[model samples]
Target: MSDDDLAATLATEAGRLLLDVRREFADASVDDRKAAGDQRSHDFLMAALAAERPDDAVLSEEGADDPVRLSSRRVWIVDPLDGTREFSEPGRDDWAVHVALWQDGELVAGAVALPAQGVTLATPTVATPPAAPQHPRIVVSRTRPPDIAM
Candidate 1:
């Protein structure tokens, strides 16, 4: 499948995941959100990867802590879904969808989709690479805003 095809596929999967997690991730205790969110992310990522890059190993935030990713030719480090706070809450901007791909410890391509804003931003073509972003719009978590920036 093409990059966009993969992205679209992941997007669809993420939508279902968000719905499935709505009650499960929200009803859980506050302390469990982190773990639960991580697990949800891990599961979604694994399923997506299995369908797309089954040959490529995965090194995700919630699972697959493979240091080999630091050396693998191609590895996917996915967050599945970001902004657990917004995800658990009703209306907030912190929520987003993330799927990061790395090659030999360097980012090759990725996508960040904010379903709330109806923004599914793609990389390179969408904007400059994030590492040396010319106009940096710092990401600040809703639950914990940065002390320096708003």
Candidate 2:
């Protein structure tokens, strides 16, 4: 319904990724063969929808990106698992959970759901708030990529 709602749902879903189960997938590492069909993130978000908004329909990246729901006034766009590659790595920040809502073909709200970081931040409906640069200059992504030290 709202960005806050989506954020809560995504956060809950991503939190489940830290669970222990009989899961093995090939897509993670090059050596493995099969992409494990474990539905950790999928199950969590699906469950969230069931518990939160049972009446609404959903189109998820890791589950089902339904073309039929494109025309709907309010459709939930979810990426249950964004960076399966980085997520598989022992230490990588290339993964993220995305939750967004579209109203009349426009993105009304969005949320970046980070379960590993244990924080859910909502995307502003308008332009993002300007950053208060405490340092001398703005560092581009080309200069910083999380692993490097300042």
Candidate achieving the largest lDDT: 1
What 10-residue stretch in candidate 2 is worst by lDDT?
Answer: 29-38
Location of the lowest summed lDDT over 10 successive residues in candidate 1: 121-130
Give the alpha carbon lDDT tens digit for every residue of 34-91 in model 2.
1231256667777876577665567887675666675667777777666665566554
Q: Each model's C-alpha lDDT?
A: 0.66, 0.60
Q: Clash totals for all models, in order? A: 0, 0
Off by over 4 Å in 1: 23-35, 104-106, 124-150
Write model 1 residue lDDT over 1-150, tens digit each, in one string: 665456555755664566566656666775576566557756877887888787777766567487766666887766766777666665564676677666666666677777656666655433544576678778668888787665
Residue 45, candidate 2: Cα error in Å is 0.9
TM-scores across all candidates? 0.65, 0.61
- Judge candidate 2 at residue 142 and give its lDDT: 71
